[model samples]
Target: MNIDKNSVVTLHYEMYDANNQLIDKTEEPIAYLHGGYDGIFPLVEEALQGKAKGDVVEVTLTPDDAFGEQDPEMIRIEPLDVFPVEVEVGMMFEADDPETGDVIIYRITDVADGKAVVDGNHPLAGMRLRFKATVDDVRAATQEELAHGHVHGEHGHHH
Candidate 1:
């Protein structure tokens, strides 16, 4: 079957940045909800539509289609006391949203004598991405899988 909404797709993919540096890869199949939910990037889901098993595709997505453009507001400076004493540059910590209690990942970019600069933007937020993918299998998703809004099997549910 071709990949479509609610279809279960299994594929191996290599992801690269604009610099052509490898970011990630999957030797094992990566499965996800096709178009039923936004489990994967919309650009990728759109590209896989109507494609069947064994098809290979190369797709490129801009920042807007991927993680999105970097927002300057996501960068903040705070008192060093806000972080643990041992926090160092490049360390990541969760900063909770006071109202929603949602935890956002923030990376410590700079730590000076009495202040720290934390950035909440995703590492690849402003970069274009390239994906080289080979579709391995495509099948109708089970009702349970659809109910959960993700694909489940080898690598676990992809949310």
Candidate 2:
């Protein structure tokens, strides 16, 4: 069957950055809710439409098509004293917003004697993403799977 809305697709993918550095890869097949669900990116779903099993595709997406452009408001500098003594650059920590209690991930970008710069933007924000995918299987989703809005396997659980 062809990959289309509500179809279950299993594929292996290798993702790269504009610099050609490997970002992520699937050791096994990854499954997702296709056609605008929260599983894969919309652009990728659009690209996979009508494709069949064994098809290999290489697609490049701009920031707008992938993760959105970086937002300057996501960058903030806080006094170094606010963090624990052992805090180091590249460490990710969650901070709660005072008004909403929403947790946000802040990655330490810079550290100095008394201040630190933390950025909350997605690591890939503002960068192009190149995806190399090999479709392993494409089939009609079972009624239960469709109702659950995800895929179920031999283990009898939805992924």
Candidate 2, residues 109-140, lDDT tens digits: the string is: 99887788899888889999998888888888
lDDT of 1 at 114: 88
For every candidate, C-alpha RMSD to the true structure in Å: 2.0, 2.6
Cα shift from native, residue 16, model 1 (Å):
1.5
TM-score (all chains, Cα) for each model: 0.89, 0.85
Task: Give the whole-model CA lDDT for all candidates, comma-separated.
Answer: 0.86, 0.83
The list of candidate 1 runs beyond 4 A from truth reads 99-101
Candidate that scores best on TM-score: 1
Error of 1 at 118 (Å): 0.7
